[model samples]
Target: MSDVSTRVDIALLGIRGGSTPVHRRSGAGPSDDGHVLIGGFGAALPIRSDSPYSLAGNKLLLDGADIGMEIEPIGRPKFYDLQTADGVSYEKIAKLHGSNVLATTVVQTCIRYGEDERCRFCSIEASLAAGSTIAVKRPDQLAEVAEAAVRLDGVTQLVMTTGTSAAKDRGARHLARCVRAVKAVVPQLPIQVQCEPPGDLATISELREAGADAIGIHVESLDDDVRRQWMPGKATVPMSEYRAAWAEAVRVFGRNQVSTYLLVGLGEDPDELASGAAELIDMGVYPFVVPFRPLGGTLAVDVDHASAPNRDVLEDVTRRVAKELQHAGMLGSDQRAGCAACGACSVLSSAGG
Candidate 1:
């Protein structure tokens, strides 16, 4: 049998998403949140009972063979059932990512949502449109939710990502304010903030000062041509700006404390993506390589079912990048907080990153 991590990666890339899911959580998916937990790993795997993979008696079964892994749906957090003093549902204020990370989009509306400018893979506002979350989560509200998530559900860390705003700070200022609020309430909780690079690189320091333990400045694809094709508005920022922000973030957050998301199945060359990840490792950035799972309401949804990279492609890139991470002595687990720390969305940890 193949190693568990490799098989899990293959299942995620090619599983039939249209089948009934035994459990579901929210972000984007065939089901609400579209996320599940398997062997301490969090993934947005397609829930298909009839496919070669299925949940049976608490074990993940593959082609009638016991994969020797136990997988279960992450139950909704208790905080989700509560409401703020202002009457907002806790879920609207924030949602649990993976099992223990409290995650929210500080600002749901992005300046680039305009038809010609939006990233094809993102539906950040779809949850807002579906009435599952609010456009802007207030600092106090987030603080309240974070406190509850920790007290009620044992949430250990928090992730706050925002849609790009028109401000020169690119929403980092707002993220800083929210981080302060949450930290004031939960001083010991590690936190990560994600956003596009601010026009003023100095704001990176402000984010760190505001109590963010780690940061993620995501450049989904390093290829300029791919960026132009998939994220027209974001691509306008230029790789130079991304490089500056990453350098500043590393200086502030320290090595392995800053990370980025590198999505596969986006028509980028597998080797090129791996090489880019190696470069990021050299810069002290953890490259979070994940399979592109198309959620409903994004431009890519139409192609998601057919466009998911084959298993060979996913494993090749993942193992290669994992090697680069190892050589650099960068492990996602060292991040202390953020997506790389949670690692439900990627298989690097399973590969020994």
Candidate 2:
């Protein structure tokens, strides 16, 4: 544990922080660990005035000077070049997330995206604003993209998430249909569906019956105050509701297959965060603790909000929760699909699982 702490500190010191042109330029390059280092200039290069973009000439160093892990780039997926029969691009329907998961936002618009209710940390519509995807992805369109991604990119799994629709089921109905459509083509592909707790508990079973291998009902933070502040609209649903939804999801998806996102830097006490994570573990849910990176164009970025939990906080919480998970025999690999299965964005998987 002490060694892990020291390594985290070294990594933190090397973090350049913020999304300036230079900082963004120095952004994540792939590492041999099967995940990209979230921050730091990819490799050290001299600041040449003539060619700012070139980092190739510089020597790669880690912990500011000592050599550490080598950085690589995530290769582009082969499906990028393919188009559906109707002329819609495969990349427009479902794109590669991390290294192997094909992910899509079934509906590009969210009910909470209005000024008053948007998650302060989310840039959910930024990709849409940039014309990176269409507004609503049809079932057929998703099926087409999934088939191509699998055949061309060697994509091993699928993730379907949606912005909260106005309907009571919060878009689970559409997600179920999308899952069914994709399964028709790729019958054995593992699929994970993410959404808010739906109005009807039956929707949980609906997703499983539709061929979803896993589900993520992300309660970004367990603390009520943090939720109210960071996710004002989503917080209206209440924690009790999230708890009930998670219970039903576990019953349907089976234990470790259900997961949630636990954002660590949201001002919650470390003990409280760990306690909540422990509770989720007891309930057979994998709590994915991700550092809050201020994505471009979110309200959080407007206020210059940053992740509060440093590497120490992240390591402490992860170590404690991981111990409990191990005691329960709940390794992340036990999960059939989703972000927890990919295990790239969070270091908890590296800590133990």
Candidate 3:
């Protein structure tokens, strides 16, 4: 359980399942993954039909040999079986992540999701086009589904993200509304809201005021060149702006309550990416570092054929970043809600980040 090399290997290489497993196909933040617990911690491993890694009973095998690791695939949540009063499926509103986190994309389409401008790593609208999720999830629908998830599946927190919008708020206002509505029903539920830096910094305060426990203003890579190449549209928002937003978010949500994603691979220098993560830790933002999975339909996979980072590179950066987080006393578990709290997507939690 202490050694997470196997966990990291499975995360990127994926696991071939003997039968259909608890997995998500697209849109969701940790999409294209099979939800499972490896040594009692939630993990999202890609579900690959041809992966050398596979599960047999409680044992994990790599090329038909047990690797001395155990896994338990998370079950499909009960809320997924219900429907809202208006007849939209509950799952279309929200879906279970890890074991007990309900996650949803409030807006399924983004203004920047167009081919040339799209973030190469994102498939935020693929689910919408496939009819798996609604384009816009109403406050009432989220509230109903959240209630069911918490009641029937023991969901402890909610992670809500929205595709970028054309409005000045850039989708923060609707997120605040969603958080407020969910809180009205599940009064004690911890909620995390993710969005681009709003045009108005004041909107950050509004989200905190609306009962959000934590926030993630994700900038996938700190290297501007990488930003431009990987997230052409997001790079248009200057790093100064991201710093401003992170500072304001920390001011409002407090230390360790604000987080961002720093993706491994995408051609970033590993040392510099780790240094950038240290800077985020100094700014009171948790950098959720993860290896890039070549998920189907993402521009990285279909258009460019990008693969996962080299295993040594991933472990090296993870260790370096985890050390800085330890020195600064920033652990993902300290965040009340969102990807950080779940710690399923990154190996940092296992490294004590």
Q: Give the Cα lDDT of each candidate.
A: 0.80, 0.73, 0.90
TM-score of 1: 0.92
Candidate 3 accuracy as lDDT? 0.90
In candidate 2, the residue pairs with backbone N, CA or C atoms under 3 Å apart (3 or more residues apart, or in different chains) clash, namely: 30-72
lDDT tens readout by residue for model 3, 89-152: 9988898888988999999999999899999989899999899999999998999999999999
For model 2, how does the per-residue alpha-carbon lDDT over 115-143 read when each residue is reduced to its tens digit? 78988877667667767677889999998
Can you write out model 1's per-residue Cα lDDT over 292-331, one digit (the tens) per residue?
A: 7655567777543435566678777888888888888898
Q: What is the full ranking by TM-score, best candidate first?
A: 3, 1, 2
Candidate number with greatest TM-score: 3
The TM-score of predicted model 2 comes to 0.85
- Give the candidate number with the greatest lDDT: 3
On a 0 to 100 scale, what is the lDDT of residue 12 in model 1?
Answer: 62
The residue ranges of model 3 lying beyond 4 angstroms of the native Cα positions read: 18-20
Which candidate model has the greater TM-score, 1 or 3?
A: 3
**lDDT for 252 (candidate 2):** 89
RMSD of each: 2.6, 5.7, 1.2
Worst 10 residues of 1 by lDDT: 22-31
Model 2: lDDT of residue 51: 23
